[model samples]
Target chain A: MLSIEHLTLQLPYYTSWWRRRWAEVLSDVSLELHPGEVHAVVGASGAGKSLLAHALLGLLPEPKHQTGRLTFQNRALTAARQRQLRGRELALIPQSLDALDPLVRSQRQVSWAASRAGHARSDAWQAAGQALTHYQLDERGRQAFPHELSGGMARRVLTAMAHVSHAQLIIADEPSVGLDPQQRNRVLDALAALALEGKSVLLITHDLRHALPIAQQVTLMNQGRCIETACASAFRGDGDTLATGYARALWQALPDNHFGVLTTTQAQNVA
Target chain B: MLSAYRLHHAFADQTAVLDNVSLSLEAGEWVGLNGLSGAGKSTLGQLLAGHLTPQAGVIKVDGAAPPRSGLQPVQWLPQSPELSVNPRWRVKRILEEAWTPSTALREAFGIEPGWLNRYPSALSGGELQRVCVLRALAPGVRYLIADEISSMLDPLTQLALWQALRQVADERRLGVLVISHDAALLERLCPRRLTLSEGRLSPPARHGAQSA
Candidate 1:
């Protein structure tokens, strides 16, 4: 349902008043997502994983940023189309807990999301509560303000907001952070259920173990570049089936695995 | 040893998050705290680090009240490094806010020199976490409450971080309380693990078929 091809984004800054310099933070990122499937984009901290998400959502702040193609459902995702489709056909579960409004309670924020997603005004609140409950937020959690809620609670509320939306594509950015084992599994299962419901899920995360189970396709990134894209099955057994050395090394680094360290070159580049 | 006796805490209009919880750790040992989210693991960590005072219990470091002023002996590294840092400050200033970490320590944490001039907002989540963890290791700091600090990092980075921390922690003989949801990670990092649930602390019963 969503496709990005050779998408690159560069932000310009002026070293001096006369000279403008561009930093290519995102480079040559390409991926495909289909209905009823979950695609995971995994990478290190500065590997520009989140940048790719922003690029797809047309949230890139650069005016001169365009060197690739983004198509959704057979139509080009132009700037205007991105604005028109955001929050209705496309919803982003932001990485930060700061995305939730501090003044509003969790349920109210989710209700607003449901209302914007074409739910009737009268049904919005009920839909929000159901979504929150589905995501494992109890009644007290739903009533707590963003600051009052724990980090994990706030993140679930964001996922709940996306869940209540009528969006066909959900971009969940690090939805598993700060959650316990059970809560993390619940969120991942919920995302898988979304895909089972025929909605496309683009899960952006750093944990391969958690994402590999539900993700049909895994895109590995390093230093703003796509390292490899492979089926999730390629991650098993010493990662020998994986296409690249970096992917194998990442898989080995899991605590349950060999706990492999990054090679000198890859380590130096990300820092 | 650092110890807490019968700690009790609850938020306004909320049930007790921590009920009669007590834990202790030696100066040269590593312990892991595993719990579901909202099970009061953070509250317990905060109380131990003196960030919060318990309603009914006392925390003592080396048989004395933990000093509320001066350099804290027990430091708590929060889960969200971005929120714990100053957005306007450069990475260098934030890393050096409490004390200056040496070149070797900086390298150990995989902090590049180029990032020092960039603002905290410019660094990715894992990079900022490295800075925060290193900053909390300033001199005179004895215990560390590392609360889900590596959950946002990739596996390789996570392994590297633990290896580096182990080296430093061993050298300094610093006690650490690792709080995380990843049971495998906790098992790898700590020899002793505790699980917090229902406002109480107990040993995790999962074994034989340990899984994430």
Candidate 2:
């Protein structure tokens, strides 16, 4: 389990020797992840969803100030502890395919992750093959380089690598971008299956429709602030049960829904 | 009018990515191309925009071959706007190099004045994409091929972009080809839709004739 309490991050820009301006990138964010549950964080482009992920992973940019209480498995998550847990107990499924090495074969890359997670080399290789197969990659696909794979195939390879590590918590950041509807559903279903196996997942995305089916709980963020956290079931049938006006507006804007007008706050936050 | 006839393309592996595909667009018409991933929809867009030469068949605008040099009437907006522009160049240079957009056009696209001096890396993906859309709608462009241009953007930004594009197309009578996997978006923006499957282009289906 993971819990973040009142997390805040600020970046300082020095205008002069003694004058500095601080920009608040994240503010008073709190979230809790239970074991075997899929929690989704949905927001627009500048809503700081990815920033929250980086902060949790200890991958935030420098020249910043951070204050937060993060606990994992009932233990405080210090920087050292994060480094120790990273890639073993916690793993990130990065948004870009460039996270993969262009020259390395897909299976080999996955095996490397297994090796890092403390598997023997021979065992790592075997697990990598199984992992690739589990993700529906074929024999040729396992041997293909990252560039040789299609967008959907490359995404599956990333998922395979993450699974081979056997991380307890997987942070997937927009894993379905550029994918077709079927491929998108496949990726989401794979994540859901991971949860079914008792792994906690934090699904970060802009599309609420994609997130609604698999997500047990949803947190709505806007302009670096967490607006509301509600049950995924609450986001249906006109959004009357939703707490905030912005959240209701977002729900209404869905194509399958009314496709209604966006509130000024929603429009400004999005554009 | 813009037309492609029996277009065929293959890569070094000698496998056809596109086969005998053909489509056409009349002036002021917004057409949608829908397909699954790796279905050669992007390859067909590239061929129509003259970014790639087909092994066989022909693509013509007004029954003439697409111009190889000078100001092109057909323009392409790729999925990744960051890759389309020169990173070293300032945003002002990138915009002016293509064509000087009217002041109204820049404002309508929500391009900030300060952004003009910054490099591409300093801008966000949505901002960069707005610049790319503006560049594609430059003076001489008559037909626009937007290949998943708004796929990475959020819903509100995506809606803003499509609205701006529709307004521009109507005012300029530009023939626009929007390539996307989003059926909702395709239905909303285009009256005529074409589906591509297994290296083939299906006949156009006239959906709702109602205006967006």
Winner by lDDT? 1
What is the model-wide C-alpha lDDT for candidate 1? 0.88
lDDT of 2 by residue, A84-180 (tens): 9888999899887889999999999999999999999999999999999999999999999998898989999999888988999999988888899
Cα lDDT tens digits, model 1, B1-212, are: 88988888998967898988878888889999988878998999999999999998889998999986999999999988988998988788999999999999899999999789777877898999999999999889999999988999999889888888888889999999999998899888888888888888885465321111
What range of 10 consecutive residues in model 2 chain B has the weakest lDDT sum? B203-212
Model 2, span B59-116: residue lDDT tens? 8997899888987888888988888899988899998887889888888887888679
**TM-score of B chain for each model?**
0.94, 0.94
Candidate 1 local lDDT, A112-230, one digit each (tens): 99999889987999999999998888889989999888766787788888888868999999988888777788788888999999999999999989999999999998888888999
What are the lDDT figures for the candidates, one per model?
A: 0.88, 0.86
DockQ (model 2, Cα): 0.48
Name model 2 segments beyond 4 Å from true: A12-22, A262-271, B204-212
**What are the clash counts of all predictions, listed in order?**
0, 0
Error of 2 at B36 (Å): 1.4
